[model samples]
Target: MRFRIKKVINNNILCVTDADGSEMIVTGRGLGFGHKVGEQVDSASVQKTYRMTNPTVQQKLLDLLEQIPYEHFLLTDELVGEIRKRISYPLNESLLITLADHINFAIKRQKQGLLYKNPLLEPIRECYPEEFKMGRYCIKRIKEKLSVSLPEDEAGFIALHIVNAELNTSMSVMNDITRFVDGCIKVIESYYGKKFDHTSLAFSRLAVHLRFFAQRLFQNGQDSGKEEYDKKFRSLIARNCKEHYQCAETVAAYAENVWHKKVSDEEILFMAIHLKRVNLSEQHSD
Candidate 1:
């Protein structure tokens, strides 16, 4: 309950330790303005307290807090609050530092007229709709608070960060997953001889499925379970939806070649079913 300021990060942030010697980073307006080492942090002055157990992560956050503007951390705190309200999943606490660092850098880039387009923007938007929506909210908040109008591409980049936090994975892994999803979608488009309707629910569903498929492939190294009922259902799907099943086969082949992992029949069957829905949705839209 009581915190002794071990170090002052800024006028608004303090690195403190509780009675049990657990380190925590506490933040609030002017919380550290007149604070000194070994000083007790007024409980009322603390608005947010991040209990950092990982020493590496704690150090990274402390470094980030020192380097970036205090207001960026405040903005990220607000964004993380909004994210918790919308998302039911437990997010990695590292999101606080990473998002704040990203926002600060993005604003610096925008001010300098350096705008980088995110190549995975569409795939990200389709695969992670909720996170992408939160990314847009992040953009809106930055514009309102910092007066920086970042490109929509930045929203996709921010969405990836949120996805990384949600999955407790690295950014590179998320990038790989998005790229794999995009490649699989391209294979589907090639098989169907047409582009997908990005806004369609079927396309969104397929994208999400492929995203998780890739995540599973990377994390679990393929599903090898082959139940009799699963085999029967796969056969039934193949027999009923020949064209879509073939498309799914092509996607499976693509995944195998790229990831060097065998795709299970269950995975292919699900892919075929998704393809069938997408095909029907495409026809209806046409």
Candidate 2:
């Protein structure tokens, strides 16, 4: 459908108003070249349409496009298209615009030698293996096309963004989820009076479990399972691994206090086992 160009940001991009009266940013080579306000854009010439509903993100994207070279958008289009094709999960459409803005800024920062490290990189890789792998792939493509070497930490950041989109949650919500997971880890550490190896496979599994656990808690308010066998399994764990089970209880207590919802017995059982394995691994390594 044809849209009226509201404003031209540059030769390659323009802000246009759709028939629904909402604004959308359209991008294509020479799409805005000689286009002016109140001008009709030939619908067939549109290469990419960013229908982002968040005004703040849209404005930031417009600002980013103004500052960065036009090629960033082209690269972002191909990268996002490939990511959509490769990832099995459904990602939010907003990611198309937001990721491009992030990568463009990241490239600019990398070039200026002002790189930032993602402190959660290890946790992210351990927790979201598939998303993190896709993040690395995004960086590889950037390196190949743009010739910029972004650090591995960038992959983690990108993965988080993907997670955000997948969850249909905002960055703030993701931050809260991360803090919730970290708080649970602290409770486990305090109970054992020692730190578990974050790099250990068992710890990674625990983190991954807690990641989805927190997500479910936020999304649906509680975990879903009513099997009597699950209760029996948890009881068995409590009897066999009393100490780790106790630690898991403390974590469960924290969850209840924060979310006002009791953690499922199945969750506590799985967590205790993971904590036990991780603790044993750490002691052996020591």
Candidate 3:
């Protein structure tokens, strides 16, 4: 797996190949040690450059460089320059590359019958009163695109694209965490159930809420204590969990199908962690 450097972006390197390749961002301190633009990276060194969860994605990055071993800086700017026109945040070069990587991998995944399965209702159904139709909405659009519903992570990826374009790019500027929460609520409630304990419901709801809370807080130029937000979000999740921690598994089932970057085991485990923290804190004094 040898690849040529297609672009040198400060500490973030990117390369392209003959077969559609992902624009991988090389990360690992000193991995860039003495590397220059257009230099062909040996196969062994390429493995040391980055650690990505997706093996196919890792190979794609390597392939891109292997295919195109030499590049001029002007070509790098040219690609970015073209993408910038359509992208909301080109200056956010790293995210731009991430999105490109996602798109390329998604296409390949599609070829391998690995489409995402948007788990909109399986988990929410147990709760019953949430009525989130996004699962259905996503299912409809996804089926139309692929002749079948996409998987959860794939749905998450597509939703990310929609969320990015509809609200704003620069997830930092994104303030729609509440909207995502509301969307989840609507999807759950839309299912055949209509009654849920507020406490049980809040756990999943708060989880959705906090997904973007940190970024929104920073974007708004506020001096927010993440611990403070974590406390609140946790309190809500715990009250819900104490009533029914069992539902956390269901919520995780949905998350597993919805989100891609993190596995469901991780998501469900974090829910417990958040709940435990809440039990200890009780409540922060004003």
lDDT of 2 by residue, 49-160 (tens): 8866678877877777787778877888787788788776788877867788889889989989998989888667756777788899999999999999999999988888
lDDT of 3 by residue, 1-286 (tens): 6566655544434442312454454533344557777676554544224434566656654545333312222232233344345433324333323444454455556768876654533333322222223323443543564454445555344344434433345543442443334444444334314533444534444544444432333233233346666667756665665532434454544443553223233344454655444333433311
Off by over 4 Å in 3: 1-91, 120-156, 159-180, 183-214, 217-221, 224-286
True lDDT of residue 100, candidate 1: 92
1 against 2, candidate with superior TM-score: 1
All-Cα superposition RMSD per candidate: 2.5, 5.4, 15.4
Best of the candidates, lDDT: 1
Native-to-model Cα distance after best TM-score fit, residue 17 in candidate 1, in Å: 2.1
TM-score of each: 0.88, 0.69, 0.27
Q: Which scores higher on lDDT, 1 or 2?
A: 1
Candidate 3 or 2, higher TM-score? 2
Error of 1 at 119 (Å): 3.1
Per-residue alpha-carbon lDDT of candidate 1 for residues 1-286, written as tens digits (9 for 90 to 100)? 6799999988999999888888989988888998799989766778988877789999999899999998888889899899989976678989888899999999999899899989889888877888899999999999999888998999999999988887778898889988888888888888888988888888877877887788788776666575988888878889999999999899989988887767888888988998999889989999
Model 1's TM-score against the true structure: 0.88
